[model samples]
Structures are given as structure tokens and as C-alpha cells.
Target: MSFITDIQQRFKKGTIVEKLIYVNLGVFILTFLFNTFGFLINYNGNFITDWFILPATFEGFITKPWTIVTYGFIHTQFLHILFNLIALYFVGNLFIQYFTQRQLLSFYFLGTLFGGLIFLLSYNYFPAFTDELDRSYLLGASAGISAIFVGIATYAPNYQFKLPLIGYVKLWHLAAIWVLLDFIQIPGNNSGGHLAHIGGALFGFLYVNQASNKKINFFDRILELFKVKRKPLRTVHKSKSRKTKPTSKSTKADYQKKVDVILEKISKSGYDTLSSEEKAFLFKQGKK
Candidate 1:
């Protein structure tokens, strides 16, 4: 097939995460064109302004409540989107292996919401910026990206990723480094944005942990509510069992044995007594 056909096929079969990246890229291009040439032709696009997060005091929320969500889609510059898209490209596929498209989208937007809330609250409430600036703004996908990172890392803490020069690193270590960096930098740097990062990371961690326990599962219910209904239903007659069948394969004994061991380990030395491999296997089994 030709290159264009190949690209078309990929798009047709691409996951929702990939499609969202495409949409963000398309919007960025439109904004760039409008800002550059369209302005000279009488079409000025403060396009980012339309989606940029504004303080609660500015009445922006009244006029553009949608900005709370849309701002995550808007990037300030080429490099800003470039780095984020690259991170998504690598991490997004890894996340899709276990999470549904809806769940992934939820994490993204929810992360953004948490991030924006922190930014607004800090700027308004803290003594840092409230006295100097009447209003402040934030625009980027970093918070959402950070959330994705934390989510995937939380899910599979021992999963290793190899870099060209640095060799392989465990996911949990990476998460720790990121979280620590954000914590250390919050005091002097963009306090609002850093606080937002912490908020996103917290959400990511809680999302994975809570999901394991079945405590958080809005996606399934939402999908069921919107699912299409069939026009008609067919009834089937029940058939009697032909005979008692003997099972060739059995897992009850094996499953119980493993469960007992895990329970014993938890009871004796606490849950952290389990090894990383043991924990990962248990987590995988729990999902199943």
C-alpha cells in the first residue's frame, strides 16, 4: 500500500488516545495559521486565550466554563506540544494494554480538572500572587501527561523501560523521581503549576489503587447508559444437561494455595513483605 493509504488505515484503527493527539495537533496547526497569516487578513486568533485557564475571580468561568476542560488541549508553543505529544506517544500505548479508552480519557480530563483547580486555588488564596496580580492564567498539557505517567507507573511499578544511553529503569523509581523533583521545585518556581502537578499525581496514584479494589468504576456505568439498544430480542429454549462432565484442567487448588501464601505473608510481616515480582503478579491476578 501507499504511504497515504497506510496512514489512513492506522487512523481508522487507531485507539482513542491516538485520535485525541491528532485532534490536539490539528487545533494547534489551526491556531498557528490563524495567528500568523489569518491575522494579516483580519482574522486574529487569540485562540489559546479561548481555552486558557483563568482565575475564578475574573468572571471567565461564567463566560467560558468549558475552559476548565479545554485548556488541557491548548499548548502555548510548538515545543510545548512536541514534548507532551512525544511523551504520550510512548506512554499512551503502554497504558492501553490494561485500561479502556474511556478510562484513559477520564484520567486525562480528571487530571486536568484537578490540576486547574490547584492552580486557581493557589493563585487566589496564597500570599504569593494574590496581592501582586489580580488574575493569573495557566495553559499546558503537562498536568495531564504527569497524571498518565503516574497512573501507568502505579499500575505496574516494576515494569522496566530501557533508554538508549541510560539502560533500564523501574517505573516506580521514575515516578518517585518525578514526584520528588516537582516537590523540590515548588517553593521557588511556578508554585501554582507545581501544585497542580502534585494534584494530578495524587489523582493518578489514587485512581490506580482504588481501581484495584473496584472502589472506582464510573466508566462501566457510563458506557452502559449510552450503549445502543437492539431492535428486537430472540428467546432461546433451555436444554437439559447431557451428563456429568469431568474437568481435565483445574485451578481451584492452585489458586487457593497461592492465595493462602499471600495471606500468610501479609499477616506475618505485613503486605510490604512481598517481593516486587510477587506484588506485580498479585496485582495482575487481581485485575483478572
Candidate 2:
């Protein structure tokens, strides 16, 4: 019970990306357990999982619309979930460095939606998939993770990562490889999945470009609608002479000046040159 409570507390306090990972892992575990039980009972378990997977046909999609988002959380294969989760952990961490948690959720969900739409359209209209349309169903977090991976790369193309064998590589280089693989695999088996990946990656590229310029987030309204508003605490003071300190307008000007100085230093010398105190101050300002 204590362990469960501790987990619950951690989840509640975790970042959006962390919470998303937990949800996906939880769903995967439940699906695995149900399938195992069904196997022991000699029953077909796909019927249970199928409802959450996005179907190719428009008619089937209309009947299970929620699958557009839910499909990204359903994974039956161990290796599939393992790779997706690992990509998500790294990409999500990188994404949050330049953007807010809300934007991350927006990119993830909107990317998943776009992926599903592309999958359905490709299956229905493409001559290559006409025969497989009726039986196709999509599942797994690949699309969502692809969005995060490509989104961050698009936002920071020059960012570097050091790998064991590859040494140092630019972010865009890795992103290009991923996108190229998806494009090349479209003609092979699992074409629908690859197409969906391309769709998600495309959205990631477009979304980051637009967001970087306009500071717009499509998911903000939806998130706000569901957000729980906390009531402000009321404090009663018995003293009649309680005085608050008056903040000078120069304080704001001084803070902005300091921020500008730090930003200029970052542009000239890179972020690593900033002192710890300067970094903390910049971070605090960013939260505002």
C-alpha cells in the first residue's frame, strides 16, 4: 500500500512527459496481462485490444474515434514498446528544454491525430493499400515519439549528441535519417505504420517552425478546459497596520536588463558560459 501510494504521489507530481510514459507503460502491462490470461483460457484476446487500435476504414474509424489518440498508447510487442519508450524519454526531455509541457502534449496528440488521418486516407485512397484497408488497424507510440524526436530536432537542428560508436552528430542529421528510413520503408511491409511515422514527423517539422515564430499552441484550449482550478487560500489578518512592501517599477526594468545581458552572452559564448546563478535567474524568468 505504501509503495502504491508513493508511486501515485510521484506520478501526480511528475512532468507531462513522465505521466504520458507511465500511462503508456500501464496500458501495455494491462494488455499483456489480459492477453496472457486469454492464452491460458484458449481465447482470442485481440477482440479486447482491437477497440483501442485505429482502424483504416472510415466507417470503422467513425465508430471508434477515440482510437486516434488511444492507438498511440497500445502496444502488444515488447520490443516495440521498449524502443518507443526509450525514444520518448530522450526526445521528450529535449523537447521540454525549449518548449512548455503543454506544447509537448499538443505535439504528441496532434501528431497522433495526423498520423491516424494519414493512415486512414492512405489506406482508403491509395491503390497500394486498397486491398488491405478493410483489415488494417494501427497501434503503438511510434507516431507520437516520432513527433517529439523530429520536433526537437527541427527546433534545434545544430544541437549535438555524442553516441558510443557514432561519436558526435547534429540533431538534424539524426532526424533526417529517421525520416528517410520511414520514407524508404513505405513500400515495404508495414507500409501503413511507416506512412503514419512520416505523417507524424512532417507535423513535428511544421509545428515547430510555426510555434517558434508565433508562440502558438493548438492544444492549449483543450488543456485549459480540463484543467483543475485551485482556489486561492484566504488569510485573515487581525492587525490593522499590516503594510506591504512597495516594489519599484525599476525592479522590472533591472530584471529585463539582466535577462538581456544573459541572452546576449548566450548568443556570443553559448549557454555553457553562463554562471549557475545566471542560469537559475534565467530559468526563473522563463517560468513567469
Candidate maximizing TM-score:
2
What TM value does model 1 have? 0.69
After superposition, which runs of candidate 1 have C-alpha atoms over 4 Å from their true positions?
1-9, 41-45, 51-58, 131-135, 187-189, 213-288
> At residue 244, what lDDT does model 2 achieve?
40
Would you list the C-alpha lDDT of every candidate in the order shown? 0.67, 0.78
Cα shift from native, residue 222, model 1 (Å)? 11
lDDT of 1 at 2: 100
Candidate 2: segments with Cα more than 4 A from true spot: 40-42, 212-274
Query: How many backbone clashes does every candidate have?
Result: 0, 0
Error of 2 at 242 (Å): 21
Candidate 1 lDDT tens digits, 123-224: 767786766345556666767777888987887676666668998677788889988988898776466667777877887787677655566665335335
Relative to the unseen true structure, what is the C-alpha lDDT of residue 102 in candidate 2, on a scale of 0 to 100?
70
- Candidate 2 to native Cα RMSD, angstroms: 6.8
